[model samples]
Target: MASPIDNNVSSAKAVLLGALASGVNGPTWSMIKITFLTLGVCLAAMLALAFSSSDFIMIIHVLLLVVISGILLVLLNRFLAETGLVSIEQQMEEMGIATKDQIELSKKS
Candidate 1:
C-alpha cells in the first residue's frame, strides 16, 4: 500500500503532467497569444532602434524584454484570478487534491 505522503506526491505529479499535456483554457490561451504578439512587436521596435543607433547595449534589450513580460504576466494573472477563471485553491478542492477539513487540520499543525 502506498503511504499518504506518496499518494499526495503521485497525485501532485499527475495533476502537473495532465496540465502540461492538456494546455490552458480559452481565456488563458488568448492572453498568451496577446503576450506573444506584444513581445514580437516590442522585439521588432527594439531591433529597429538598435539598427538605427551606433551604440546599442544588448543587456538593456534583454532587461526590457524581461521586465515587460514579467509585468504583463503579473497583470494578466491577477485579472484572471479576479474573474474567477483561475482559482488554484478551488480547483484543488474540486479535484480531491485538498479538502476543507484537511486544510484546517494542516493549518492547526
Candidate 2:
C-alpha cells in the first residue's frame, strides 16, 4: 500500500544520491553502496510480501523470492568482480579521462 510506495520513493532517492556521491567522490564505493542498497530493498520487498500474505502460501512465496534473489546476487557479484570499477577506473586514469578530482580511490589502491 502506501508503505510500499513510500519505501520505493526513498529507495529511489538513495540510489540517485548514491550516484551523485559516486560521481563527485569515489565511483567504486558509490557503486557498492548502490548495489547493496538495491539488494536490501529487494530483501525488504520480499519480507513485506510475507507480511501481506500469511500461512503456507507466504512461506512458498518467501522461499521462491529468496532463492531467486540469492542466485541473482551471486551472479552479479561475480560479474562485477571480473569487470569491476577498478578496471574501468584504471583505464580512465591511464587515459586521463577522469576529472582531476574524480579519480577512483579503489583504483589508486
Candidate 3:
C-alpha cells in the first residue's frame, strides 16, 4: 500500500504535468494573449517616444526602461499564470473532478 505522502506527491506531479501539457489552454491562453498584447502596446508606445524625442540620452534611457519593464511584466505574467493553473488544479482535485470528466460534464450541462 502506498503512503499518503506518496499519493499526494504522485497527484501533485500529475497535476503539474497535466498543466504543462495543456499549455495555453482556454483560460490560460486568454491571459497569455492579453499579456502579449499589452507588451506590444507598451513597445509601440516606447518606440514612438524614442522617435519623437530630440535628446539621444533621453531616447536611450526610455529604451532601457522599457526593456526592463517588459522583462518584469513577462516574469510576473508567467508567475501568475503558474499560480493560477496550480490553484485551478487543486480546486478541481478538491471537488473530486478529473479533467476529462469535468469536460464531459460541462459539455452536458
Candidate 4:
C-alpha cells in the first residue's frame, strides 16, 4: 500500500504531465507571440509620439501609426495563414504529407 505522501506525489506528477502535454499542442504560444508583436508596434508608435514636439502632430502621428499597424497586422495574418504557418492542417495538406483519407484510415485502425 502507498503512503498518502506517495499518492500525492504521483497525483502531482500526473497533473504536471497532463498540463505539459496539453500546452505542447495548444495555441498559447502563438497567441503570446502575436500579443508581443502588437505590444512592440504600440511601443514603437509611442516612441514616435514622444519624439514629436507638437501635440496635434503627435495625435495625428499616433492615429496614422495605429491605422497602418492595423492594416499591416491584417495583411500579415492573411499572409501567414496562406503560408500555413498559422494552421497545421493546411500545412500538412499543402505538403501532401497527411491527407484526410490517411487520417481517416488511421482513426479506423
TM-score of each: 0.34, 0.40, 0.39, 0.36
lDDT-better candidate, 2 vs 3 = 3
Worst 10 residues of 3 by lDDT: 1-10
User: Model 2, poorest ten-residue lDDT window?
Assistant: 1-10
TM for candidate 3 is: 0.39
Candidate 3 regions with alpha-carbon error over 4 angstroms: 1-26, 69-90, 94-109
For residues 1-109, could you state the per-residue lDDT of candidate 2 as single tens digits? 1222223334344444434432321344465657777977877787787777766787787778777877876786787666544333333444454544555333243
All candidates: CA RMSD in angstroms? 10.0, 11.9, 11.5, 12.3
| Cα shift from native, residue 107, model 1 (Å) | 36
Total clashes in model 1, counting residue pairs 3 or more apart in sequence or in different chains: 0
Q: Which residue ranges in model 2 land beyond 4 Å of their true spot?
A: 1-54, 86-109
- Could you tally the backbone clashes for each prediction? 0, 0, 0, 0
Stronger candidate by lDDT (3 vs 4): 3
lDDT of 3 by residue, 1-109 (tens): 3323224444445544445553322344455567677977877787787788777887787788778877877886787667554434443445454465654554454
Model 4, runs deviating above 4 Å:
1-33, 36-54, 86-109
Model 3: lDDT to the true structure: 0.57
- For lDDT, the strongest prediction is 3
- In model 2, residue pairs whose N, Cα or C atoms come closer than 3 Å (at least 3 residues apart or on different chains), thus clashing, are none
User: Which 10-residue window in model 1 sums to the lowest lDDT?
Assistant: 1-10
Q: Rate the local accuracy (lDDT) of all candidates.
A: 0.56, 0.53, 0.57, 0.50
What TM-score does candidate 2 reach?
Answer: 0.40
